[model samples]
Target: MSASAPTSFDKILIANRGEIACRVIRTARDLGYRTVAVFSDADRDALHVQLADEAVCIGEATASQSYLNMTAILDAARRTGANAVHPGYGFMSENAEFARACQAAGIVFIGPPVDAIHLMGSKRLSKIAMQDAGVPCIPGYEGEEQSDEQLLKEAKRIGLPLMIKASAGGGGRGMRVVTDASDIPEQLRSARSEAKNAFGSDELILERAVMRPRHVEIQVFGDTHGNVIHLGERDCSVQRRHQKVVEEAPSPAVDDALRARMGEAAVQAAKACDYVGAGTVEFLLDDKGDFFFLEMNTRLQVEHPVTELITGLDLVAWQIRVARGETLPLTQDQVQLNGHAMEVRLYAEDPAAGFMPQTGPVLAWQPASGEGVRIDHGLRAGYRVGSHYDPMLAKIIAWGDTREDARRRLIRAVEDTHLFGVTDNRRFLAAILRHPVFAEGAATTAFIGADFADDAGMHALAPQSHHWAIAAVLLSSQSPVTTRHWRNSGPHTQRLVLLQGDTRQTVSLAVSATAGPGVLDVTVGDQQHTVRLGASNQCIDNQSIEVDGVIRQPAWHRDGTQLWLDDAGQVFSISDVTHAPPATTAGAGTGQIRAPMDGAVLDVRCAEGDQVSKGQVMVLLEAMKIEHSLTSDVDGIVASVTVRNGDQVKGKQILLSITPDAPEA
Candidate 1:
């Protein structure tokens, strides 16, 4: 056992931004240590910056120039007289070189040893090490020879339905599941490309995809005194696009005996690397009670709140203590897992649009709060959510005496959370929590794709008549009371054409003054409804209204001809185009291929005059840390390409144009 003398640091610097930085600052302040925060230009007014004792602007908005800028971060700590730095997950959190640099600069690094991070950071090397340590691992190829031909040959030998994973980094980036042999080549290329962009490494490892296995991970902690212990397991099988959406502690599938086995294996994995501070060892637990090592995250995880709630422990505090050369507060047997806890990640994204990330001002922010509900976020009214960072905005956690109790509380918490002015997945999260499979704790990694893939709520729904009615009332109310009187006509009729996506709804509205002040008698189709409006609160962009005797207080915002409304968790966007002119086009058959979201152009596959088939990918864009492929909608010849590789673009910006082929020649 290696021992070290206890050290002290008066102030600590956080080398990241957003909720995680705020999380660390809270604990550090509670421990009576002064805290400093660093931010990019985009996050100058971020919640974390406001909460810190002092903040320093690191660099520009892009991550490469800011959060991931190791030299700038270290210099900030030096300039601030911070004796220690806490890298709160992501953006060099697990980087071995950063840890070494911190140590060399005489700044205490509050994480595992540099050697441990260097060894386990690579999936290929970690698997080999785990195998040598007698830890169970899935059978796959982790060879040094990373040729396309070699990978193809190995794929056939490994059989169908295998996974290709980037050797470095996590977060579901650079991962592909190949169920058919024909997809191996393209999937390989995509995975390698993403891996290179995300982790600076294109090397990969292959694993036989475990069928319907639960993604269970054991949370482990270590100290410089050679003590290591586990905090039990969290079931993270519920996922979308290989990214974890929901996480819970004390996995329903892990009984006492199974927990003992998995826990011991996780401890051994940590001890093998001489780990210290906090880490998690993930595994794929099959129905037969067999578990295989997946990977080890060498820093605090995004879902650490679940473990903290159940154990009644402050993990960040433990990290600080261990960094000061203090032994772990509790041993393996002394650590008690008390209650069940569940957590859901809230993202600023549109589930109806293939989970594309959204960015805009936060018109309103009301997070849920209760005895057992906790929210960790960095959001505020009027805060601008940019496209430069990850879309995840907050985490909601709930704890109860039992799993069902925790699940119920979490569901309610999700429903109660309110956010406006941007598209998000709150509705989708509530649906997942209410799912029968998830409620019964039978969810696997295939849960999202199998059950909710085609859920109607996951797609754009046509606007209902009531939606247009509400929009008409709001639009009419924008004018003076005198003009809203309809010129004292016996019956004033108005027409509205509201556009949502590519679908439009035309409604004929006839208003009568007899409905009284703040009310109107609006006719839609053959039905007449009484609509009453309350005073608008522009501060939060919300108002109370009664439609057909049903009272609802929905938050709404208006920008020119567009209106955004949020009722409960559902959002409706209505654009008044009643007097708008016909659409114009430069090519044939919806020929303009536009970017799906704000992103950097990774590749442009077609040039001018190139023949392309329907559904053939013409542009590759990277946004919110995910790659999106923009495809041609009709068979045509490309007329022009407006964007070049490495060009940053906004949402709906045209990338190219195609001229459709003549029919029936």
Candidate 2:
């Protein structure tokens, strides 16, 4: 690779979607290149589509036909007369064959060489590269070990809390944490199964696990001509299930000396593979400050915004620049970082419900703003959140003069946010941002685990806040203060929403005819939560609405007197008691709840009702969405059976019920 600008390629094809696609297009446009966007059928009206100079529908709902389809992406590039192709992140971003295809078609692939991609793509192969580069690595069996006996010998060397990682894996998939030696065999089997299903490879790698370590990575850039520079480090220790939830720059943990060591290690690793363009060298830093090489990502990362904010560099633009034969404009000595930056991933999952992926239309949405807040979003309000790709909805990034300022600002940003529709985990993110431990920056990869012991901890705030918010909103159900219930000045009635866990109050409360619309004021105790409504809140062209300060589209439904609010894949039912039945016979129906969705049978309690206590776990269901336990609504006897073992039931379907007794039954 050389450091001279080649000066070619008039048009480039972006073979991805979501924020990454838009991210690449922004850089391409700045580089005087016409951009073409390849979108799936589900992304026809996506934000990226609107941003691209040209857009072509690549395939159906699933990624198999669109982003992952090599032929389709290459064909799009060829059809669009694009001389270069950018894979962005995920999908085929690191696929060696995909890169080679672009080269074969005479189009520049905006990544490392095919050989480097292939070598680093395999964890086993990368181990060899890292070893050759003198990078510190945990003792593991990257070599062939067929029998349990052979693997066990290596496991003892790696010690307990070992990891069973897939040779062909990234983004935390195809990996398992094995804590006990006795669990190794079964885990090996399951890990291999997951790897096969996910990456079409059962080739597994084993490595020692670091105890309570910070997940830090150095962002490095390289060129064809023996040149490379490190862009400091990013702290991604705050995570859940080995995936980063929040990320920041200039780690509160890593000082200058440690950052230098990591930066040098990262530079050497990149040079070992002769890497080019934007990439990351991940590391697992132990409690004792000792570090071990985790893996090298040969493409842009989702949390690149943090680095960009601190270094005042557009990583995507630099990637394009270096790919186009430009030297890294800044030298190693010139590379300096200022200020602190934090980024929170907004996912479409319910944190309380085990972070399961949710899908629906964005009924209302508005990204947080003011000061240093920026939102890298994929969908607009009203756009449907599909189940085809990742569940991440957006990246809400904020920069501040210091880490504490960033933390405080991010919390304020979230609190002011108001959203509904397509369920987003904004509130959960807000909770994490404001968490005492997180605020102190004493985080590790297992941070979420260290704190969120239960559903209440997951939210990190008083349950009454929601109650107050709902109460304020519900107040809208009553007429305005100026008009009495008997008077006709104010609107008589309004809409009261009931979800599985939360409630909302909406109304057409008017002060003047020209007032247009107002807000839903939710009151709890001494606090009042106001959510904007009507014209000022709507997106105009889309179904999404913006109330307070968050971006969300809540899932909603109505049945009889109960209105449900589905936010981020969680069904929170709030009672709409305006019309509930007055009274029932002694033993009729206590309305025993059942499984609301399909999931694995984890635990089961209670047989028939047998006069069980309220909120008692009746059964447990573990789905890809998350884990939830069904509880009894009231005391009664098991009345009917509609489902059994492994049966998948739709929401609201009666699985088993406890028919109330007539006092003597």
Candidate 3:
């Protein structure tokens, strides 16, 4: 690879989808380069495709047939006469073979060198390289012996509470935590299976788990001219399922001294592999200020916005410049860090339901915008979020003079933003930001487990009386026959049942003449409240609800009998089940098994006529890049199997059925 000659290209192809692809297009267009977007059949009409100069359909919705199809991506670029390809993270970003193929095809790969990607893509090899470079690292086994017996023997030496990580991938996929010695074998098998399914490699790497440590990483930029520098650090400790949900720049836990040391180590790691372009060196920072090298991500990260906000630099632009054989724009001494910045990922998932990935049409989307706020997304009102990709929908970033200021601004941003129809973690993100531990900058990797047990009060929370009243008034107002519902000379009342989650409440509403028009008295249970709306018949859009004496401006979306309300930051989904029949509760030990979401069957652990116990793992479903173990709710005999291995199943589709065992006499 020669860095002496500058290479220039007129067209650049983005080899990814969603926000990241849209993100790259913005930068490439700004730099006067024509952008080509490659899309799968599912994303033919996606936001990124519409934003690009041209788009090519690569394959079907499945990742293996589209986004991961290297030949198809390269073919799209070749057909469009694109001389450059920017793999916008994920997909083929860390794929060394893809990079090498691009180089062979005479197309500029706007990322790290192929060798750097190959060495850093593997956790096992990267750890060895970091150790050889004299960087601080945790004691672990990254041996070539990948046998179960060998891993089990190594686990005994490493003791309990070790981390089982995939050597070929990250993003919490193919990773497991083994806290008991006896569970090592199962964890090893699970990790290897996931590793192969996700990265096509089942190689395992064991690391001594660093309990309750801050996940701090340095953003390092390298150019073809042999120059590399760090742009400070980011604290990414607030995570769930080993995936980061919130990230902030200039870690509150790191002082100037600690930053300098970590920054130097990150630069060393980049240079060790002769890296060029954008990369991240992750570290595990302990309470004593000591840090250990984790691994290096060979491409742009999902949380790069916060770092860009603090540094006032476009890392994507830097990658393009470096691909053109440019030198570092700023030296180590010239680099500067500005005010604090924080970002939170908005995912289409139900935090109360084990953070399971959700899929549906985005009925509405109104991202918050104001001073110091930035929303990066590719969402529109009617775009359908599919199960073929990741669940992350968008990212909200805020910058402020201080960490607290950023936190407060972020909380407000989350409150103002609204996305209905599909469930999200917006409220959950707000909870983490407002938590005392996070407010004090004391949160670690265990923050979610420690502070958000049972989803941090999210699951247990039922709609308040005010919520019910507001919902009832809104429902009554939206009725087509508004004359009888909104205005009544005599005493006229209506009763309705609103269901939220498993909690059902019957609310009675009556027109109240005391507060002029659009006023109604609502009663839920024994509590009565005065609910005033802005208009008599207006139910959708922005509405004002003055419950009792308190007033709140809430955004609402009504689809048929289902209503979604975003009051401040707390979101509620209320269904008008008044005319609907009472729902029958499936027996506690029912043998009906259904798929939770649209996914592919990875394994069927039971067969027809097989006896199964309640809580036994019956099937493994893979959806949105995560494996879900479906268990039997009752002990029974398998009567039928509707899904086979590698079969695609829709949400709520029955995977199998079992005949319940005879009850005790």
Candidate 4:
């Protein structure tokens, strides 16, 4: 175990999935190490599986049955003859028991020491440890008392506008912001339930929510040789639901003095637990320029690419080198920060609809490519996105000499990136990048909620006459025909009802003889336009259409009468209600609760014949690792419950039915 000894492992098993696994594989391969990938049934054909030197099927689609199955992961490593295990980010990455298991199995875990993981894994314990280490921490309650009365008492003592967080939770799960004292009880219940389901722990922690604080985290690394260094800091202030959306290096608010202080505090926090390998110390900086320790993430962060871009270093590579007993390559003074770097997390979720996750096949994916642009993803055409995991599809990073330059480049890159079949947040991220508040570098944690609360990004773009005309022409014909049917016969007109959010547009395509063989006279409301159809390159659900004289290659995915078009960065769902069936009125007349998205029913709150009030929780559905409660729209007696707990449901599927209240019997 000498510090200078050569790394022992020839093959490293990545016990995780998605972009992070692929990320680690690339770096390990560059270091001349063969990589093994463990995959769940859902990820059988994932890009990471194909890129690895060896692949193993661990278990089922659910994370607990697969990626989180420590025993199965270790067995896969043993079967593949892998001498080391790299827990890439999410699954079991910071689990202390997983690290200990790796050590007992005689495999190198490419992360921090087991003690460090244990200490930072619990929010309550980590806050106490940070205070003891002389790190400034937020005022809150971190006691052993678990009673509801005790928690209520502490919340009152801490004052209102506090945060209730799960001791063992990350990624914004098991966390709630309580503004009013009356809402604390309900928030506490929800947080505990989500925590137990997500992390197998129900421990709670309370902290005073800092108003409009900037989230800044210092990336620190350590080695077995007792060397540690901080690689500057990243500002992750642009967040939604307490999770980071956009991250950038060299925070706009931090100067040399503040950075030095934060970096020193981060390094001290790491040393307090004898931490080793890559870890991040998060802090919330207030308006007064004071920073408080939040927590520590003992794994490669999702926003690590921004740090790498600014520092000219591969953090994953450093992790492996450190795990192999290598000392720090550069001292704190030697490490230099370069140009500004920014990253946006591209997710398959609809920002217009409460950021609900969407799942489907990736019909077409064209990532942006140019100078200063980098796409880190595990996505490919034909890849199926399931609701069994996170909704993030990729991370796009851009670097420039200035923050504005980096921001502009990232915006342009996001505009060029196109995806189909699944609804995504590409336009949403672009909007955030171009917002004046963000452009001025003054975005805090309240950026999303305050500035773009209504999701103006998706609705800001009004469909032009040309856009409607293009849609009409594409929908009028399925193939190229030699004879002009409308010319030979009478003028035939087709009507299309296109829906975008709540707005609906009726487009009529009138095929006439005077117009060419493939020409159509389109009319949308009072706007009239002439559109000519040209050669189309159709690939499954995707198509490149030439409308009028302009050629736009829009990624298209059609399901029955509904078509999704990804043109540039804008996404539109066009429904051709030409041959649609009559709607059923029975469920509409009565009260019916339908599933919001494709997910598994986690709990059923009511049974048949049960009386329920309006806005009462009827069914709880779990999708994309988040729980959504389906509430009753009208107070009525339950007539039938179609779905039970553990039942998988599709979007708009009826989960239960309620009969209108009866008059006096």
Which candidate ranks first by lDDT, i.e. highest?
3
Off by over 4 Å in 2: 1-7, 454-665
Clash count, candidate 3: 0
lDDT of 1 by residue, 443-532 (tens): 999899897677665776565667667877776566343224554456666677778777776665555466654567766666677887
Order of the predicted models by lDDT, top scorer first:
3, 1, 4, 2
The sequence of per-residue lDDT tens digits that candidate 4 reaches over residues 554-627 is 66655555666667777777766656675467544468898877789999999999999888888889998888
The digit string of per-residue lDDT tens for model 3 on 259-306 reads 999999999999999989999999999888889999999999999999
Consecutive 10-residue window with the lowest summed lDDT within model 1? 479-488
Model 1's TM-score against the true structure: 0.91
Q: What value does the lDDT take at residue 263 in candidate 1?
A: 98
Q: How displaced is residue 135 in candidate 4, in Å?
A: 1.6
lDDT for each of the candidates?
0.87, 0.72, 0.89, 0.86
Q: What C-alpha root-mean-square deviation, in Å, does candidate 2 show against the real structure?
A: 7.3
Residue 659 of model 4, lDDT score: 85
| Candidate of highest TM-score | 3
